[model samples]
Structure formats: C-alpha cells, structure tokens
Target: MNAPTAVTRSQTADAVTVILFGAAALVVTAISTVLRILGTFRDQGIAWSIPIDEQPIDATVDSGAASVEGIAQEAMVFAAGVDPVSTAAIIGSLALWALAPLIVIVCVMVVAWNLLRGRFFVRGNARAFDAIGWTLVLAPVLIVLLENVGLNGVTAAMGLETEGPVHPIEFWSIVPLFATGVAVGLIAAAFRQGIRLQRENAVLEHDTRGLV
Candidate 1:
C-alpha cells in the first residue's frame, strides 16, 4: 500500500485538534458561566443588623437599645463602591464569550482551506492551529477573570469586614488556565517544528529538481 500523503495527515491532525480545542472552549465557557452565577448568588445578600454600643449610665441600667436599619441593596455598587478590576473582568469575559464562536468558525475555515490547498503539512497549518490553541486558552482565562470581578464587586458591596486578605473564589480557575497555557505553548512549539520540516522538504525538492 502507498504511504499516506502529507496533506492527508495534516488534514486529519488539524481536524482532530480543532475539534478538541473547540470542545474545550465550550466546556470552559459553560463551567465559567456556572461559577459566575454561583458567585453572584453567594454575593447577593441584605444587611441583617448593624451593631451599636452605648455606655451604661448606672449599674442597674443596661446599655441603650440597639437600633437597626432595613435597607436593600443590589449585589454590586455601581457608583462609589465599584471595583474597577472586577468591572473590567466582567466586561472582558462577556466580550470573549461573544467572540468565541466566531473564532472557532475562523479556525475551521482556515483548516479547511489548508486541506483543500494541499498545504496541511506546511507552515500555514501549524500557524492556524497555534492560533486556535491560544484562543482556546484565552477564552477560559477571560471567563475566570470575569467571575472573579463579579465576586469581588459583590463582596465589597456587601460591606463585610474581613480580618485579613482572602480570595473570594476557590483556586480551581487557575488549574484550567494553567492547562490552557501549556496546551497553547505546546501547539506553538509544534507549529515551529512544522515550519522547520516544511522548509527542509522544500529544500530537498529543490535539490532533486537540480539533480534531474
């Protein structure tokens, strides 16, 4: 049997990688949305009581009666209490989510174009894969950042005093972000390798032509 063509191999690999990254992006988006909603729920609350203390006038008489106010406030403070970091995160996440499908579509089109042109093993395919990988990685990070922002804003607006610095959400977001980064880096390295191979193949082809 004849060996598979370079173009055929490249097309197969590209299709698999694109599907993998596309699935990953979708999963990350879903998880991030759930986390953000949970964070929002955790942030939403009303002030139960405000403690006020007073000195006692006499031994027999106790301290003055405490007064409490009943006020409802939104989870986020739009004016004075807004956290700029969290605000930016929310905005960035929304933007990323909106653009993710378009990015995927573009990546698919690039892979299809390369396959049709018989350039799957060339530098272009590698570059396209690298781009898709990086975009996938970025999508999750943006989503996590948005969730963090929403949580931070909610916590601040709640007026809860903390003894020390503490992050509102669990550190799981970092895990996926780190994984995505590693994947992107690997894909970039693979692209570089593919470019080198393509250059070498072109040189060999030129040498063969000269020999003939």
Candidate 2:
C-alpha cells in the first residue's frame, strides 16, 4: 500500500484503539465497583492483611448480625469517612487506576498522531514513549501500593480485625505482578524504538522524494 494510505489506516486504527479501550476501561471499572459493593454485603467480613504461614479464617464477621439495613448503614459510615477532599483524591486515583490501560492506549494513539502530523523524528514521541514506559512500569506498583494503603487505612478506621490466622496470598503472586509490569515496560521500549525507526524512515523518504 501507498504511504498515505498506510498512514490513514494507522490513524484509523489508533483512533479505534483509543475509543474501544477507553470505553472498555470505563465499563469494566463500573462493573468492578458494582461487584465490590455487592461483595461487601456478604456475610463474611473483609480481611485486611494476612499473617505468615497460616490459613485465613473468618474473624470479625457474624452472619447473624449482618442485615441488608446494616450493610446500608455501614456504607453510609464508610462514605462519611471519605470527606470531600479525600473523596476527590480517592475518586481521582481510582479513575486513574481503572483507566490505566486507557492511558497506555492514549499514549500510543498520540504517538501515531504525531507520526502522521510529521512531528519531530526523535523528540515527537519522547514524551509519549516516556509516558507509556512509565505507565506500564508503575501501573501495577501504584495499584498494589494504593490497595495496601487503602486497606490498612480502612481497617484501622473501621476497627476491622480478622479473628483467625490470616495468610494473605503468598508473596509469589506479587512477584508475577511486578514481573508483568516490567515486561510491559520492555514492550513499550520496543515500541518506542519502532517509532523512532519509522520517524527516521519517513524523514529519509521525504528527502528522497525531494531529490527525485
């Protein structure tokens, strides 16, 4: 295919990627939040942290004492703890977390747009590449960190405690998560290289056309 046609297709694909990924992220996030809300209504109490080498048991929850009304009341209490300032911060962070894939998609879209627009061969995508790399590398880390902090905060605030020895998911799970993050970062770096090569080829082709 001709360069112009290829570029057009590239742009179209990028636009579609942005739209589909963004929409999916929003939908998934909403579904996840809804599921979490429903889960909170279960008879079991939410476990915060796990101790080493022990199976987690139901601690602070009493199914007999739990009621739909009580669940609603507890939700109100939880919401109250999230004051406006904290609420905004939490919302913003959660938005970012839920939209993490969208962020990467947007970055990729921006890089493609820049290439079509004939921006800097090297520098045009520096920021976009950097964003992509860092987003991939830090997304999981930030999520884990935020989740731990949030869990601890809520547990302390609500005086939540597990009765039995709680052994959270083994540290092995976290290792894979971190490894996946690193793998994504590596892929982003590879994409950055490809973008750089594309930019250089575009420049070279332009020069050849000028000479022709």
Candidate 3:
C-alpha cells in the first residue's frame, strides 16, 4: 500500500487543527453568552445571593467620636438592591464582556482556516498571530478600563460614593495574561522563519523534479 503523500499529510493536520480550534471556539462562545444573560438578570435584581459577601462598618463621625482605626478599617457594603443599573450601562457592560470571548474565538478560527489553505503563507499567519497576541494582551487592560469606567458611572448615577479605590487592578492575575500574549507574538516570529524555510525547500524540490 502506498503511504500518504505530503499534501495528504498537510491536509490531515490542517483538518485536525480546524476541528480542535473550531470546537473550542463554539463551546466558549456558548458558555459566555449564557453567563452574560444570567449576569444581566442578576444585575437587574434577580436571585444573586449565591455570591454575597457582606461586611459591617460603623460610621461614628457624626457623633463626634470618630476613631482613626475604626474609620480606616471600615468595610462598606454597597448594594444595588432593587435599583437596576441604567439600561445603557448594562448593555454596554454585557457587550464588552461578550466581545472578549468572541474576539478570541474568531482569532483562533482564522489561524485554523489559514492552515487549511495548505500554503503556509507567512503574511496570513503573521496577521493571525498578531491579532491573537494583541487580543490576549489587551484583554486585561480593556477589562480594567471598562470596570473602572462602569463603576464610576454607575456609582455616580446612583448618588453613591465608593469608600476605597474602585476597580483596583489584580496585578498577580494579569501578569500571566500579558506574558501569554508576548509569548504568542514571539511564537509568530518563529513560525515566520519556519514557513520561509519550508517554502524554499518546496521550491528546490520542484526544480530538482524538473531537472530530472
């Protein structure tokens, strides 16, 4: 029996890549959409007690007996209660959350589709890598920005003053995300070199066949 040709092997690999990436994308998108819907309902004052963590604080300033330690260690419990966020803010937040996973899914599919084309073209691959890398990198940044912006807007709208810093960045968690993005960008450079070498070898093989 004849073994598979180089073209056949490439096609098989491409198909596997497409299936794996595509399936992952579909699953993540579905989960994100569902969670977003549920979150919107909770924000609108549905059953949200599953994640409640309440703290008590005493404000004795008006009694002329304010203590520095007590005031500094005070824990504020800011609740939306039955008051819903503005329709615009709710929609915007959900849109941003939904867009994050969608962007990732699209980038993964783009890379898989390019592989299926069987050309190993450097430009297309580079674009895909750049997109994925930047998306991963900027995802955390966008989240932070959106959180702070949304928090300030909603609080102001509700005539509330935040006790401490609003939407503080969790640097420990974000470090890994930024690192992964940079790693992907570096991997794209490596792929560019590999694609160039592959193309040159293909060219040489064609020339040899013609000469023979």
The candidate that wins on lDDT is 3
For candidate 1, write residues 1-212 as lDDT tens digits.
11124566766677667667766776776777666545433343321122223433322223545544443332233223446675565556666765665565566667666665555555556666676677777776666656555555545655654223335454465566557656866876876776677678778888999999
Worst 10 residues of 2 by lDDT: 70-79
List, residue by residue over 118-167, the lDDT tens digit for candidate 3.
Answer: 54555666777877788779876766554455455444544666323433
Q: Alpha-carbon error at 91 in model 3, in Å?
A: 4.2
> Candidate 2: where is the Cα deviation over 4 Å?
1-22, 34-96, 105-132, 158-172, 202-212
Identify the superior model by TM-score, candidate 1 or candidate 2: 1
TM-score for candidate 1, please give it: 0.51
What C-alpha lDDT values do all the predictions have? 0.57, 0.53, 0.60
Worst 10 residues of 3 by lDDT: 44-53
List, residue by residue over 6-35, the lDDT tens digit for candidate 2.
Answer: 346666676667656656766776788666
In candidate 3 the C-alpha lDDT for residue 195 amounts to 71
The candidates, ranked best first by TM-score, are 3, 1, 2
Clashing pairs in 3: none
